[model samples]
Target: MDLHYLDATPTEAERAAVDALLGSPEGGNGLDPGTVHGHGDAHNGGHPNGSGPFPAHGAAHGNGSAHGNGTRDGRDMLLPALHAVHDRIGWISQGALNHICRQLSVPPADAYGVASFYALFALRPRPSRVLHVCTDLACKANGSSELCDRLEQSFGPAGTAVDGMTWQHSPCLGACERAPAALAFEAGDPARTQLLAPAGTDEIEESARSGPADADREPPARESVPQAGDPELRLLHRVGVVDPDSLDDYRAHGGYIALRNALRAGPAEVIKQVTDAKLMGRGGAAFPTGRKWDSTASQPVRPHYLVCNADESEPGTFKDRILMEGDPFSVIESMTIAGFATGCAKGYLYIRGEYPRATRRLANAIAQARERGFLGRSIMGHEGVDFDIEIRRGAGAYICGEETALFNSIEGYRGEPRSKPPLPVEEGLFGKPTVVNNVETLVNVPLILIEGGEAYARIGTERSTGTRLFCLSGTVARPGLYEVPFGTTLRELLDLAGGVPEERTLRAVLLGGAAGGFVRPGELDLPLTMEGAQEAGTTLGSGVVLVFDDTVNLPAMLLRIASFFRDESCGQCVPCRVGTVRQEEALQRMAGGKAPPDGDDLALLREVGQVMRDSSICGLGQTAWNAVESAIDRLGTLSKGGPA
Candidate 1:
């Protein structure tokens, strides 16, 4: 890599702003003085034990400065520095990258690698404003392609800046309820990032032409789902009924009571209750939540870590976003209880970068909780027990949803998954024993503790206990988030979502998101439980049920799904990197009438898929071919002569 390209330097004002945000003087490096290092002493740079295999990924170091204080080194500031430079100047100039690398002691090549990994960071010079339009499956069904075409007609082709703005098609923005979502990012004021759902040409044009002030206009109100007051709702009980911003309202609706009970019962009892409940993780893995907590607690390592995986980027899955934006306090309370049970004093909530509303609500909730003593030193006045949480935002990397990759992102590295064996529970975040649970998994903690594990277990099936959040999207009469038990049949779920529209027959259903397989309409009676889905050669991944009607172009949709995996693969390993590209090319050939009808492309696809699954490093590669494979085998996607 050439070093000269990274010679761009940050302006004096940009350096000052970053220093002020980090609370350090010029050229300072290390954590700020008195910054809590959980169970370890702050002077030791947060890692009491020696550095792990990848020290630069998570190790915190202190530099000998005149101030003699521990200021976070350049590695720790990678994300913040990127944000500062991008905010101060429209795009990350080579000068800015060089300046950031110099400040953090990061090599320019390594720094450039990290910067280019995320979708938000722009290495080359770009227009001050950028419009990221969603063209994923959910949005595509809702005319996102037409929206993109219209924008291109008005603002020129994708990636071209018209009147100082660039528009580009993007992956899922996690806002399926209000489909056709677009995010407007303006330079100079990062806080004013605007989300436009049902984004029209006029709205996007106005946003791009005007400055940040116009971009800050309130988004159109989303239509409310009909199931809010269904009485059976657990996770979403408070979503639409209560004011999301009002803490008093949340407390009034029996919030924090679970935390109080957990505190009274102590950590051991809390873990026991969870174990008894047999609660499975809702983030598709279905791992026993209690066992994960128990294993992390049993670790001999000091200063254990707890991570809340709120990076909900799975296409057509918006359940976590609904919970976070609606009941932010519950997430905070749940993380606190998780911290106590796992003997973790420090927690990190990694939310998706696209979820502006959820991010705001969570940040507000954390601040409010800290003020009320629910967080910070001696949480809720439990002397000698300290628990705190820090929110880390993801910079548009889908692979970061993986636990190890998320930890790496928090440690200021490229969001790529690490090899398993020293799994997260063994040697996870910061090279310590850590428990990483998704938002839905952590949200269940308080409920299990309050109702007693057995009582909670009675709500659902024996294996998949308790209620699950199902995201219903695509060509359905009522497409929204639905709360249902694990044993609920796919047919019943569709009925709850009001089924397909009048006169429309269901063609097929994608049981999960892109990483999940498909089930034909005939299998509607199949139970939506984990066991049933597996038996059907599919998965109830993230509880996403995307309904496809007779009018849908199945071949095109499968091709789009293939394209998504190809674009999002982190490219760390050969199987996934090359396999995804090969899979996409084969799918494109078949979809474009280029493949012979002798079934060679489909066979090649299956072979490539299996290789990726068997040899890939992470789940992203393993499941990349899921939707396409399922569509071809189960739904006759390619047999129907390409695109309808």
Candidate 2:
């Protein structure tokens, strides 16, 4: 709640949408039964008109601090409210924005800022339905371009609606296993969304012309777990073996046994086990999970918080999505363990919006967990251990993957990374000690507690303990989630996936992701361990291994990667905001040129990349140049015939 910025009067439909989410104003906050809120007296130069400045008024809210005169602030609901409006109406209207402001005690300008920050929430009016086709790395390697061409011939263009629906290119939908994917999101009561993987033009047309019911539904996440029932598969043992929707199925497979073990052992023992296990985060940072839990638990602060970072938006990474959709109970149980170990009473599972199936399964799991007393007060019949998880959906900003930026997004601000040092463990989520772990990292906790730290530690290299989930996509014969020990070499993993199709020879492997590096075919012997990757001047970042055949247009892929960075940059800091744009421009110039790429363009790329790496606030900016640099240096890409 800031100064009076609500100038426009909301339509009945707009007001109803906000009201549905925030509750009616009748007898409480906002307008009277007959009078509209913010509809100042006509004599005072304010009415329910779309124009005319709002008249000044005293604080109407009951709580106050950093914001305006109001004592009440519903700013945390900003993202959800914007979502409500967008889901009800295809786009966010000025009136609807102002209405949400009044309901949430937020300023109109601030609401507008938050609304425009997300790619999913359109400020202007749009069709009620949207078809998001993936033109990303894995999809491109598949037949995504041809799919787009087919879509173009059927529909007018990507954005223009043929009837009441339209399709547009999207970044990775975290369905990398199913390349050439398309997601349809329709707005209205009981809004519908469907995934169209291996999206044939006919399916897209049918879904667009009629409804998602006419198209094939996405396969269960469990189906994507290639090594599901393998006794050796620690992370994915129950993925396809157990029913995702059943708590009984999860328990029969040994779910919550870790929580019971954890409760009996106490938080201290749990931390010690994780420490001895030497488990690291799977969220690209590879930070020691034990150290993070220890620091947060040791903090003098009260009411510690745990955030399950499930917003997996990395261009070629989708392991977390698979895990959440497959063994959702494990993620929940792990988050519970984390909350208990860290003394956190509340945990937030910040998930991505595109993961509808995962979201649904997680929500169901949370409800079942709460109902069975596995998540509420006195968990497992123990005294005074209270913890619950709330799911937060990210609208579509890659930067929110950064812990601080995620904090900001949850707090209802634009998704942008904040400066560190008062790091997240020290001051996070409402400025408290917080332990944040991604889905894969948290799911491993159950294994550590059950297997004993020493045994879990022995699964992989002594340095990088336990198994790793690699998202093997692109030209590989089998493109899916593969779990292997850390010491496994790239060649071994490729072989495990059956290598590229017999006709297509491997050109290179894009390890990590857009922010990761590229490896030449000869480098396949490199061990798939963190230390191994670092020693080789690259990283196993988030376990993304996107393979490409020699037939792909590699430079175009580089340009697409460049465009992803440029589009996703929050533009809060100059280094990433400007560097990403310049990088894309340089790639376009060099790739578009008929002559050989000049050394000047390559040099310029390096210079800009260095500046971004050195000055960018978050990892997104710091590693923006990583993949491009790897392509240039290792694969000799972006040159005479680059990225091929």
Candidate 3:
């Protein structure tokens, strides 16, 4: 853990802020239907019961009212299996969470909470080809709404070819400010939908799987390449530079050149290429990919592992979607290389439940790779190094983004995060040393191996090197994914994103995702670097830059964020469990019409926020006070009944 990025250990004043934010606290217990219907206040009553395990996808579906064979054991078998199916399909198009709940013996609230909490489960069966527009504050400013409208008009019942396509509003696909943005994937394919950005009607429809192509038909021409400024180019880049699923297409774009070289150079030389690249993890915590590989390589474990973290739930980041959908094979190739270097025989790509298409595509690609001799036993006829990969689905807990939590979720347990010490390299997945790399970081391996790591390292800053796939959103004219060198100024990114709104002045920018702190307009000049942001009292969390314009109220905004964390907290630790609820009460009280009487109450709330910050176990409790502190610091004078 780096000290510079973390603030001073929770101060008394900070603890007060946490407490104030959580004005009231609630208890944790199992959810009861009777209590839900007539109880006075379940809000303040207690935590709903959240426990147990079951199958992955053999449950029932329908409206909230039960319709299936109602047996306790039968229902239990059905729930997890239903979740598995829904996770794979993106929504319970044919069944409701309530139906699954009744069939599985889980409370409706618990079932619904699990369904709604994650991004994968959709209440309604989306269009055959789903397009999730990025509507987070950043993309909102970038004309994302307009893009959605355009898409709906063209694809909806009233517009062009309504035969197979459908469009729906998807919450943040994490590509904020990459506006006029959206991610497109087939509903049933599961293999096609990896997170993508800057995608709109034209791009989606162009590459969408409309129908089966003629088996004998020739491939499309590669003559017309799109320019960077072109809208289609932006969408293409967001979908990944290379489309790895198409062997012919990838070959045309110089796809297997790196793999051929890796096979020729052998594992040691391949490892050196990656080591020289200086590529850091694209997944928030910028750990070096080479070092992770080196540790795994040094260990003589027989079945070494290379797991790709594709569970992209960071509120403002979605670069992985592009890699998984556009060039999934790159990830496969990278993992294969890792297996060769580390003497590993297997790999897993942990994709979020929401991205069924990416999962499906990778699964298919893996099968194809095996047939083509790229994976399993001998690769392209070479002996000595053999590898294979599998896909694992996450149940949609944000905490699962934490590595240990991810492992637990994979192990068929509740997705609560775990404390880390015997770091992933030494102890991960079944007590074996593992290498878990971000989707983007693993994809970059092929590039680094093909080109020396030093060449790759030269693109970005000293500490943060290489081109980063930044999911830019909020208040910008053009919102979408941008691959730029690290340390780029906020102003430059904003400009590249087509600038902020003309009518509204800029307010504050949320760097990283929900866990990160804010930077007001005055701080726009702050360099967009991990170290630089830390210096300015914020961290580049998940690299999702969400900018807000003046129309947004900071206090109210902070309240919504606090509420989100409060609702999402797994309730494993008291500081986080009770403290978040308290924070919510304080924010509501302060924001509500009734203002606090001057001294003591205000002081108390502030103190609570600090204690929660200091005492909370995981990232959820620890940094959750960031927005509240920023809000109070920026708007103390404007607060109701305050000095103003």
TM-score, each model? Answer: 0.91, 0.92, 0.69
Poorest lDDT segment (10 consecutive residues) of candidate 2: 47-56
Q: TM-score of predicted model 1?
A: 0.91
Stretches > 4 Å off in candidate 1: 1-6, 27-74, 211-224, 640-643
The alpha-carbon RMSD values of the candidates against the true structure, listed in the order shown, are: 5.4, 6.7, 15.1
For model 1, residues 1-644, the per-residue Cα lDDT tens digits are 22344435667756654554443334334233333212233211111111101122123332321111323344655775676667656677777677666555667777788889998778777888888899988788878888887887787889997788888889998877667788887766344577887677777667667734443254422243558777888887888777777778989998889989988998899999999999999999999998999999999867688899999889999889888877889999999999988998878888887776677777778767877888767777889777777666777899999988887887677888888887788877767788999998988887888789999999888888898888888888888888888799999999988898999988889988999998887889998788888998999999888888888888778888888888889999999999999998997887787986337887898899999999999999999988888887776677655335
Model 2, position 287, has a per-residue lDDT of 96
lDDT of 3 at 207: 40
Best model number under TM-score:
2
The residue ranges of model 2 lying beyond 4 angstroms of the native Cα positions read 29-72, 214-216, 594-596, 640-644
Better of 1 and 3 by lDDT: 1
lDDT of candidate model 1 versus the reference: 0.77
